[model samples]
Target chain A: MPKASAKKSAKPVEELSYEEALTELEGLVASLEDEQNPLEDSMRLFERGQALVAHCSALLESAQLKVQKLSGESLIPFEEESE
Target chain B: MQPTLFSSIHLTVSQLTLHIRKQLENDPTLQDVWVEGEISNLSRPASGHVYFTLKDKNASLRCMMWKPDAARLRVNLQDGMAIEAHGRITVYEPQGTYQLAVNLIQPKGEGALYQEFLRLKAMLESEGLFAPERKRPIHQLPNKIGIVTSQTGAALRDMLNTLRRRLPLAQVILAPSPVQGVEAPPALVKGIQLLNYQLPDVIIIARGGGSIEDLWAFNDERVVRAVAESKAPVICGVGHETDFTLCDFAADLRAPTPTAAAELATPITILDLSSDLLSARTRLTSLTLNLLAEQKAVISSFISRLKYISPERRIQSAYQHLDELSRRAFSALTHGIQIQISNVNGISKRLLSLNPEGILSRGYAIITRKDDHMVVSKVSQAFGKMKVRVSDGEFEVNRGLDTAAVIE
Candidate 1:
């Protein structure tokens, strides 16, 4: 009964901070690059890595916007002026 | 008193300078004097010294704020921050003029100037100039880079060399302009607008380090506005690490120096890109190999199972089944034959039992005349010329001489 209850109540892992997620993603990348882990473990890591990547991407997107606002400008293509 | 002319002359250079300094220090009018004027020709030297001219409508006096006093002032000293300085007027013999040696300086309240900066900032911000959503992302690998700096300065050269070294494929377009003085602001603004029209992937606004006065053009409202309004992502690399300008804030990115700007603008080398591609290819190949290995393992397992089942045993089982079928077939055939034979024997026995001859052998016979096979039983028939078959043998029948004829 205890085992069944544990299985029924199991929740997904908590969301990580941007730095944590990025670190995890880097670790996943390194592990994948090494190619030494078992297939099942690798698949698990890949799933986690996908989540981390999404988190990092969101963080970067927001950070870029904040920087742009602070800088008070639109960062766009350069245009030239005529003499 | 008339006899000693040297004594009458009386004062050495140091003594005269000290006397003047002490007198000015004690003078009540010169001390704590409030002078309202336009500031001009402000100079901050390497030795942490400040020299500027404070002028009224008619005349101007040279003022000096040594490093310690200037450093103590809270507000930034600009060419036009109308300020009141508490100082004494003293004569320097070499200059032959009495100047203000300032001890304390404070702003006269930057009401109009500060308000203008705020107003412009708010106007641009309300127009979505400062909106994060409007800012464009810098390209990871820009094919073309535009630089807005003086053509003669080290800034342009640094950026060019960096681009060449890091990203050889990148084409650099130099939008040369003056980087200092009054002309710099207009030139920079025009350069930015021009670059916007040209539409380069990325632009760098850069300048070497200088005094605040020298770098003032970058702080101009026009230059800041232009930078903020640029269509291209502008990177401001104006001066050393310690220096900052309005352009830096308005720019999409800021680098510590021209070299750092180059580094930020283009960091990836072709070698790195190729190495990344190669690594990706290797990863794909490894994944494929692993998948193939798993498939091979499954196939080998199936083969082993097939081998373990034993083909010879399967054939032997088939042979045993065939033998069992043959035995059943033979037994069925024998049983059918026996049934048929028994049926035939029963029919023959019934036929033998039914036969009249068989009855005769049982001590019974059908009596008949010798000439015919008809059965006769009455004596009258026996009197007529009848031959009869008895159980023992055949007999001929004879008519008796009638006593009845003698009697008639």
Candidate 2:
């Protein structure tokens, strides 16, 4: 269900995965180049594209790997299990 | 001597051998047994029966295994190989010797474990569990990754470090399980099943390198089946580069070590993604600018042609043409009048030369008869009164007297 919702652009740029953000950005560029979209529509597409680029760059800039354990219903930070 | 030892029982050689065979075969411990020893003097003749001597530091026993049992052996039998053999003790009456009848044989230590590994590998392969089509391609960019490994083991730390260095954006879910010992096989199965519920893009089952006995859990049939059945593709990294397990065969992919598994999971690094993003950003700007340039060109061309044929421009040019024509006509009229004046002056001068008044002015006199207004050139032609005209006055005269004087 989460992945299904993620496919739509309604999700915020920060929440979108790298693949998702890049995919939507590329789509916007193609539409702008190939179609005679209205000026207002083109402006909207361009702004969204810029935001996606920023989000992707930020993700790459400040990322840290996190490992977690699947508890009953939540994920907790992974710790060493006692032998 | 027989009479002296009459109290003891005397037995024939064949009878003694048969009695000994019965005693050994009838014993429950010797009826079915397992013995461990080093092989020596191993031989296989034309009869297809294998004969060998099983020995240790203290004693040695002759052993025989039929062709059927030897054919089922997974490892090659050689002299000096320490092996565990299962059969019963039997005595050959003719040779009068007791030997082990080996129905099953396996090399001891790691060799025994390897034999079982081969057996399971063969079985799984025959069932198509290790088929090429069964293998799935790992996700290029996995957002969520599931790992089944020992939380306390070095393998877990190595894998985590590798994942962090390559792709820090990925979220890893650890399913802790023991990687060795008798309890490890079921625990690994549970770990794989638990991760399956989360629906990760990939699952990595990993453990550090170890001896064959220490890594035998990965060769467990239950674990191998679990790996084969995982919904997400599994990458088995159980042992060293040279070590292999049945789970490795069943997995979608295999890596030599836990760190290698982490690397395999993240085929694309953060650097690669960053460059891709940069290019996409560049394309977005360039494409939009190009579209604007194309539209500007169209608009400018439209403006140029629109200006070319406007009515305002046409009327202004027409007014300029009218002014030019009127100026040329006025100059032409003035030139024609001047030419006419010169012609009139020349005609008037010529007319003055022919005028009689002009001759009289030169002091020439003219005489004419008044009645006919004719001039007389000979005296005989003058008969009536004549008129003489001068520049300022005129007088009348008689023509007969003049004519006679002229004739004299």
Interface root-mean-square deviation for each candidate?
A: 10.5, 1.5
Task: Assess every candidate by TM-score.
Answer: 0.44, 0.63
Please write out the lDDT profile of model 2 over residues B1-408, one tens digit for every residue. Answer: 446766677899988888888888899999788899999999999888999999999999999999898888756899999988889999988878899999988668655566777788888899999999999999999889999998888999899889999999999999889999998999899999999998999999999987677788998999999999999999999888988888888999999988999999999999899888888899888876776787789999999898897787989989999988999999999999989988898999999888988999899878888889999776766667889898898889875766667775
Model 2 chain B scores worst on lDDT over the 10 consecutive residues at B1-10
Which has the greatest lDDT? 2
| Residue B266 in model 1: lDDT | 73
After aligning candidate 1 to the native by TM-score, how far in Å is the CA of A73 from where it should be?
25
lDDT of 1 by residue, A1-83 (tens): 21232123123324564445544445455656655665665666556555555554554344311100001133443332223
True contacts kept of 1: 0.00
Per prediction, the TM-score for chain B is: 0.49, 0.59
